[model samples]
Target: MIGKRLKRLSPAIGRAYIQLIMELDERISEISATQLQKQLKCGPGCDGCCIQFSVLPLEAAIVAEAAVAKNVNAENNGESCSLLKDGLCSVYEVRPVICRTQGLPLAYIDEEAGAIEVSACPVNFPDDYPLSHDELMFMDSYNGRLAQLNVQYCTENDIDCSVRIPLADCVC
Candidate 1:
Protein backbone atom coordinates (compact mmCIF):
# COMPACT_ATOMS: atom_id res chain seq x y z
CA MET A 1 0.00 0.00 0.00
CA ILE A 2 2.75 2.43 0.88
CA GLY A 3 4.63 1.44 -2.26
CA LYS A 4 1.56 2.29 -4.32
CA ARG A 5 1.32 5.67 -2.65
CA LEU A 6 5.00 6.33 -3.28
CA LYS A 7 4.48 5.62 -6.99
CA ARG A 8 2.40 8.76 -7.37
CA LEU A 9 4.95 10.98 -5.59
CA SER A 10 7.90 12.69 -7.16
CA PRO A 11 10.98 10.48 -7.59
CA ALA A 12 13.17 13.30 -6.33
CA ILE A 13 11.50 13.17 -2.94
CA GLY A 14 12.12 9.44 -2.80
CA ARG A 15 15.79 9.94 -3.57
CA ALA A 16 16.14 12.50 -0.82
CA TYR A 17 14.48 10.20 1.69
CA ILE A 18 16.87 7.40 0.75
CA GLN A 19 19.85 9.74 0.94
CA LEU A 20 19.05 10.79 4.48
CA ILE A 21 18.81 7.21 5.66
CA MET A 22 22.05 6.32 3.91
CA GLU A 23 23.86 9.16 5.60
CA LEU A 24 22.57 8.05 8.99
CA ASP A 25 23.68 4.49 8.36
CA GLU A 26 27.14 5.75 7.45
CA ARG A 27 27.34 7.69 10.68
CA ILE A 28 26.34 4.65 12.68
CA SER A 29 29.02 2.62 10.91
CA GLU A 30 31.66 5.19 11.70
CA ILE A 31 30.69 5.28 15.35
CA SER A 32 30.65 1.52 15.63
CA ALA A 33 34.05 1.20 13.99
CA THR A 34 35.75 3.94 15.97
CA GLN A 35 34.22 3.82 19.42
CA LEU A 36 31.30 1.47 20.17
CA GLN A 37 32.40 -1.84 18.68
CA LYS A 38 34.03 -3.08 21.87
CA GLN A 39 31.07 -2.30 24.09
CA LEU A 40 28.32 -3.03 21.58
CA LYS A 41 26.73 -6.38 22.31
CA CYS A 42 24.15 -6.09 19.55
CA GLY A 43 24.55 -8.45 16.63
CA PRO A 44 22.48 -10.68 14.37
CA GLY A 45 20.07 -13.05 16.17
CA CYS A 46 19.74 -10.62 19.06
CA ASP A 47 16.14 -9.52 18.67
CA GLY A 48 15.42 -8.64 22.30
CA CYS A 49 14.74 -5.01 21.41
CA CYS A 50 12.90 -5.66 18.16
CA ILE A 51 9.55 -4.41 19.33
CA GLN A 52 6.68 -2.99 17.30
CA PHE A 53 6.76 0.74 16.70
CA SER A 54 5.37 3.43 14.46
CA VAL A 55 7.19 5.45 11.82
CA LEU A 56 6.70 8.59 9.78
CA PRO A 57 5.22 8.28 6.29
CA LEU A 58 8.57 8.74 4.58
CA GLU A 59 10.10 5.93 6.65
CA ALA A 60 7.09 3.69 6.06
CA ALA A 61 7.27 4.18 2.31
CA ILE A 62 10.94 3.25 2.10
CA VAL A 63 10.57 0.15 4.30
CA ALA A 64 7.48 -0.93 2.40
CA GLU A 65 9.23 -0.54 -0.94
CA ALA A 66 12.15 -2.65 0.28
CA ALA A 67 9.86 -5.37 1.62
CA VAL A 68 8.00 -5.49 -1.69
CA ALA A 69 11.23 -5.73 -3.68
CA LYS A 70 12.52 -8.55 -1.48
CA ASN A 71 9.18 -10.41 -1.54
CA VAL A 72 9.14 -10.45 2.25
CA ASN A 73 5.91 -10.57 4.25
CA ALA A 74 5.54 -9.28 7.78
CA GLU A 75 4.50 -11.85 10.31
CA ASN A 76 3.03 -10.30 13.43
CA ASN A 77 3.71 -12.79 16.21
CA GLY A 78 1.86 -10.47 18.61
CA GLU A 79 4.96 -10.17 20.77
CA SER A 80 7.57 -8.40 18.63
CA CYS A 81 8.04 -6.53 15.37
CA SER A 82 6.32 -7.99 12.32
CA LEU A 83 9.45 -7.37 10.27
CA LEU A 84 11.43 -9.85 12.35
CA LYS A 85 11.81 -13.28 10.84
CA ASP A 86 13.72 -16.00 12.67
CA GLY A 87 15.11 -13.44 15.11
CA LEU A 88 16.48 -11.20 12.39
CA CYS A 89 15.02 -8.30 10.49
CA SER A 90 13.77 -9.34 7.06
CA VAL A 91 14.20 -5.81 5.74
CA TYR A 92 17.33 -5.02 7.69
CA GLU A 93 19.03 -3.07 4.92
CA VAL A 94 16.30 -0.45 4.80
CA ARG A 95 15.19 -0.36 8.42
CA PRO A 96 14.06 2.93 9.94
CA VAL A 97 16.35 5.40 11.73
CA ILE A 98 15.44 4.19 15.21
CA CYS A 99 16.45 0.65 14.40
CA ARG A 100 19.77 1.77 12.94
CA THR A 101 20.96 3.21 16.25
CA GLN A 102 19.81 0.53 18.63
CA GLY A 103 22.15 -0.53 21.50
CA LEU A 104 24.38 2.47 20.89
CA PRO A 105 25.11 5.29 23.31
CA LEU A 106 22.15 7.58 22.65
CA ALA A 107 22.01 11.07 24.07
CA TYR A 108 18.95 13.29 24.14
CA ILE A 109 17.95 16.36 26.02
CA ASP A 110 15.81 15.77 29.07
CA GLU A 111 13.81 18.96 28.81
CA GLU A 112 12.05 18.53 32.14
CA ALA A 113 15.35 17.85 33.89
CA GLY A 114 17.08 20.56 31.87
CA ALA A 115 20.07 18.36 31.13
CA ILE A 116 21.33 15.84 28.64
CA GLU A 117 20.97 12.16 29.45
CA VAL A 118 22.88 9.35 27.83
CA SER A 119 21.70 5.76 27.67
CA ALA A 120 22.56 2.46 26.12
CA CYS A 121 21.48 -1.13 26.30
CA PRO A 122 22.14 -2.54 29.76
CA VAL A 123 23.48 -5.71 28.23
CA ASN A 124 25.87 -3.70 26.08
CA PHE A 125 27.15 -1.53 28.89
CA PRO A 126 27.58 -2.22 32.56
CA ASP A 127 25.66 -0.19 35.11
CA ASP A 128 28.90 1.36 36.35
CA TYR A 129 30.17 2.07 32.87
CA PRO A 130 31.07 5.68 32.43
CA LEU A 131 29.69 7.21 29.24
CA SER A 132 31.75 9.90 27.56
CA HIS A 133 30.29 12.90 25.83
CA ASP A 134 32.38 12.38 22.72
CA GLU A 135 31.09 8.80 22.30
CA LEU A 136 27.43 9.68 22.72
CA MET A 137 25.26 9.75 19.63
CA PHE A 138 23.31 12.96 20.00
CA MET A 139 19.94 11.97 18.53
CA ASP A 140 18.29 15.39 18.30
CA SER A 141 20.40 16.51 15.38
CA TYR A 142 19.66 13.45 13.26
CA ASN A 143 16.03 13.36 14.31
CA GLY A 144 15.64 17.01 13.33
CA ARG A 145 17.06 16.31 9.90
CA LEU A 146 14.75 13.33 9.50
CA ALA A 147 11.79 15.46 10.53
CA GLN A 148 12.67 18.03 7.90
CA LEU A 149 12.86 15.36 5.21
CA ASN A 150 9.64 13.82 6.45
CA VAL A 151 7.87 17.17 6.26
CA GLN A 152 8.97 17.67 2.69
CA TYR A 153 7.89 14.15 1.72
CA CYS A 154 4.57 14.40 3.54
CA THR A 155 3.77 17.81 2.10
CA GLU A 156 4.40 16.61 -1.42
CA ASN A 157 2.47 13.35 -0.92
CA ASP A 158 -0.44 14.78 1.08
CA ILE A 159 0.26 12.65 4.12
CA ASP A 160 -0.37 13.82 7.67
CA CYS A 161 3.06 14.20 9.21
CA SER A 162 1.60 13.95 12.69
CA VAL A 163 0.03 10.57 12.05
CA ARG A 164 2.59 7.86 12.52
CA ILE A 165 2.01 4.58 10.66
CA PRO A 166 2.62 1.28 12.42
CA LEU A 167 5.60 -0.68 11.15
CA ALA A 168 3.39 -3.70 10.40
CA ASP A 169 1.13 -1.59 8.21
CA CYS A 170 4.13 -0.59 6.12
CA VAL A 171 4.72 -4.20 5.05
CA CYS A 172 1.06 -4.80 4.43
Candidate 2:
Protein backbone atom coordinates (compact mmCIF):
# COMPACT_ATOMS: atom_id res chain seq x y z
CA MET A 1 0.00 0.00 0.00
CA ILE A 2 2.71 2.42 0.99
CA GLY A 3 4.91 1.46 -1.90
CA LYS A 4 2.54 3.23 -4.28
CA ARG A 5 2.90 6.51 -2.36
CA LEU A 6 6.66 6.10 -2.16
CA LYS A 7 6.79 5.78 -5.91
CA ARG A 8 5.47 9.33 -6.26
CA LEU A 9 8.47 10.87 -4.57
CA SER A 10 11.80 11.28 -6.30
CA PRO A 11 14.92 9.74 -4.82
CA ALA A 12 16.56 13.15 -4.48
CA ILE A 13 13.81 14.41 -2.21
CA GLY A 14 14.03 11.25 -0.20
CA ARG A 15 17.77 11.70 0.26
CA ALA A 16 17.32 15.36 1.24
CA TYR A 17 14.63 14.53 3.76
CA ILE A 18 16.76 11.78 5.26
CA GLN A 19 19.70 14.16 5.50
CA LEU A 20 17.58 16.69 7.35
CA ILE A 21 16.32 14.02 9.71
CA MET A 22 19.88 12.94 10.39
CA GLU A 23 20.93 16.50 11.19
CA LEU A 24 18.01 16.87 13.54
CA ASP A 25 18.91 13.61 15.26
CA GLU A 26 22.50 14.73 15.66
CA ARG A 27 21.41 18.04 17.16
CA ILE A 28 19.06 16.29 19.55
CA SER A 29 21.84 13.97 20.65
CA GLU A 30 24.14 16.91 21.26
CA ILE A 31 21.52 18.69 23.33
CA SER A 32 20.68 15.56 25.27
CA ALA A 33 24.28 14.94 26.10
CA THR A 34 25.06 18.48 27.25
CA GLN A 35 21.73 19.62 28.73
CA LEU A 36 19.40 16.69 29.32
CA GLN A 37 21.89 14.19 30.71
CA LYS A 38 20.34 12.19 33.60
CA GLN A 39 17.17 14.27 33.11
CA LEU A 40 15.35 12.59 30.24
CA LYS A 41 12.78 10.09 31.49
CA CYS A 42 11.65 8.91 28.07
CA GLY A 43 12.82 5.52 26.82
CA PRO A 44 11.41 2.16 25.81
CA GLY A 45 7.88 1.55 27.21
CA CYS A 46 7.22 5.28 27.17
CA ASP A 47 4.16 5.48 24.94
CA GLY A 48 2.21 8.27 26.62
CA CYS A 49 3.01 10.65 23.78
CA CYS A 50 2.82 8.00 21.10
CA ILE A 51 -0.47 9.12 19.60
CA GLN A 52 -1.71 9.55 16.06
CA PHE A 53 -0.41 12.70 14.40
CA SER A 54 -0.12 14.30 10.97
CA VAL A 55 2.99 14.88 8.90
CA LEU A 56 3.92 16.49 5.63
CA PRO A 57 3.87 14.37 2.48
CA LEU A 58 7.66 14.27 2.59
CA GLU A 59 7.62 12.86 6.07
CA ALA A 60 4.85 10.45 5.25
CA ALA A 61 6.71 9.19 2.20
CA ILE A 62 9.85 8.57 4.23
CA VAL A 63 7.89 6.77 6.92
CA ALA A 64 6.06 4.70 4.35
CA GLU A 65 9.34 3.66 2.82
CA ALA A 66 10.65 2.62 6.21
CA ALA A 67 7.48 0.71 7.03
CA VAL A 68 7.73 -1.11 3.71
CA ALA A 69 11.38 -1.91 4.30
CA LYS A 70 10.60 -3.28 7.77
CA ASN A 71 7.58 -5.20 6.48
CA VAL A 72 5.48 -3.44 9.08
CA ASN A 73 1.75 -3.90 8.81
CA ALA A 74 0.64 -1.53 11.53
CA GLU A 75 -2.97 -1.44 12.61
CA ASN A 76 -4.18 1.85 14.00
CA ASN A 77 -4.85 1.42 17.72
CA GLY A 78 -7.53 4.03 18.12
CA GLU A 79 -5.72 7.12 19.42
CA SER A 80 -2.36 5.41 19.86
CA CYS A 81 0.36 5.30 17.22
CA SER A 82 -0.01 2.45 14.74
CA LEU A 83 3.75 2.05 14.65
CA LEU A 84 3.79 0.84 18.22
CA LYS A 85 4.37 -2.89 18.56
CA ASP A 86 5.28 -4.72 21.73
CA GLY A 87 5.33 -1.33 23.49
CA LEU A 88 8.09 -0.07 21.19
CA CYS A 89 8.08 1.88 17.94
CA SER A 90 8.39 -0.49 15.01
CA VAL A 91 9.72 2.37 12.87
CA TYR A 92 11.93 3.86 15.56
CA GLU A 93 14.89 4.35 13.23
CA VAL A 94 12.82 6.41 10.76
CA ARG A 95 10.37 7.98 13.19
CA PRO A 96 9.17 11.53 12.54
CA VAL A 97 10.68 14.72 13.92
CA ILE A 98 8.00 15.06 16.58
CA CYS A 99 8.76 11.61 17.93
CA ARG A 100 12.47 12.33 17.93
CA THR A 101 12.14 15.45 20.09
CA GLN A 102 9.46 14.28 22.47
CA GLY A 103 10.20 14.61 26.23
CA LEU A 104 12.90 17.16 25.44
CA PRO A 105 12.82 20.84 26.34
CA LEU A 106 11.17 22.72 23.44
CA ALA A 107 11.18 26.47 23.06
CA TYR A 108 8.63 28.26 20.96
CA ILE A 109 7.63 31.82 20.40
CA ASP A 110 4.25 32.36 21.95
CA GLU A 111 2.65 34.70 19.43
CA GLU A 112 -0.17 35.74 21.71
CA ALA A 113 2.12 36.28 24.67
CA GLY A 114 4.76 37.95 22.48
CA ALA A 115 7.50 36.07 24.28
CA ILE A 116 9.48 32.91 24.19
CA GLU A 117 8.18 29.96 26.18
CA VAL A 118 9.83 26.68 27.04
CA SER A 119 8.10 23.43 27.88
CA ALA A 120 8.83 19.74 28.29
CA CYS A 121 7.00 16.61 29.28
CA PRO A 122 5.82 16.93 32.88
CA VAL A 123 7.38 13.61 33.74
CA ASN A 124 10.71 14.57 32.22
CA PHE A 125 11.36 17.82 34.06
CA PRO A 126 10.81 18.87 37.64
CA ASP A 127 8.44 21.76 38.31
CA ASP A 128 11.29 23.85 39.57
CA TYR A 129 13.85 22.67 37.07
CA PRO A 130 15.94 25.65 36.12
CA LEU A 131 15.97 25.40 32.34
CA SER A 132 18.71 27.34 30.65
CA HIS A 133 18.06 29.12 27.38
CA ASP A 134 20.72 27.08 25.62
CA GLU A 135 19.15 23.86 26.85
CA LEU A 136 15.89 24.52 25.05
CA MET A 137 15.49 23.39 21.44
CA PHE A 138 13.91 26.09 19.34
CA MET A 139 11.40 24.27 17.20
CA ASP A 140 10.79 27.13 14.76
CA SER A 141 14.18 26.75 13.11
CA TYR A 142 13.87 23.03 12.61
CA ASN A 143 10.21 23.19 11.65
CA GLY A 144 10.96 25.92 9.13
CA ARG A 145 13.59 23.78 7.48
CA LEU A 146 11.23 20.84 7.41
CA ALA A 147 8.54 22.96 5.84
CA GLN A 148 10.92 24.21 3.19
CA LEU A 149 11.95 20.68 2.35
CA ASN A 150 8.33 19.61 2.28
CA VAL A 151 7.49 22.41 -0.11
CA GLN A 152 10.27 21.31 -2.40
CA TYR A 153 9.14 17.72 -2.21
CA CYS A 154 5.54 18.65 -2.85
CA THR A 155 6.45 20.81 -5.78
CA GLU A 156 8.49 18.07 -7.38
CA ASN A 157 5.86 15.42 -6.69
CA ASP A 158 2.94 17.63 -7.84
CA ILE A 159 1.38 17.34 -4.38
CA ASP A 160 -0.26 20.08 -2.39
CA CYS A 161 2.20 21.67 -0.04
CA SER A 162 -0.44 22.06 2.65
CA VAL A 163 -1.46 18.42 2.57
CA ARG A 164 -0.93 16.70 5.91
CA ILE A 165 -0.81 12.90 5.79
CA PRO A 166 -1.66 10.87 8.87
CA LEU A 167 1.18 8.81 10.24
CA ALA A 168 -0.89 5.63 10.47
CA ASP A 169 -1.84 5.87 6.82
CA CYS A 170 1.81 5.57 5.90
CA VAL A 171 1.96 1.91 6.94
CA CYS A 172 0.84 -0.82 4.64
The model with the greatest TM-score is 2
Q: Which ranges of candidate 1 are over 4 A from the true structure?
A: 1-9, 110-114
* Candidate 1 structure quality by residue, lDDT tens digits, 1-172: 5555653336887677677777777877877886568989899999888999989888888888888888888796787999999999999988888999889889999899999988788998888888777677889978988898888888987788887988888776
- Candidate 1 residue 3 Cα shift, in angstroms, is 5.5
User: Residues 8-52, candidate 2, lDDT per residue (tens digit)?
Assistant: 557776677778888888888888998578898789999999998
Q: Find the candidate with the highest lDDT and give its number.
A: 2
Q: Where does the lowest 10-residue lDDT sum fall in candidate 2?
A: 1-10
Candidate 2 deviant stretches above 4 angstroms: 1-3, 6-8, 110-114
**lDDT score, candidate 2, position 154:** 82
Q: How does residue 38 of candidate 1 score in lDDT?
A: 90
Q: Work out the TM-score per prediction.
A: 0.89, 0.89
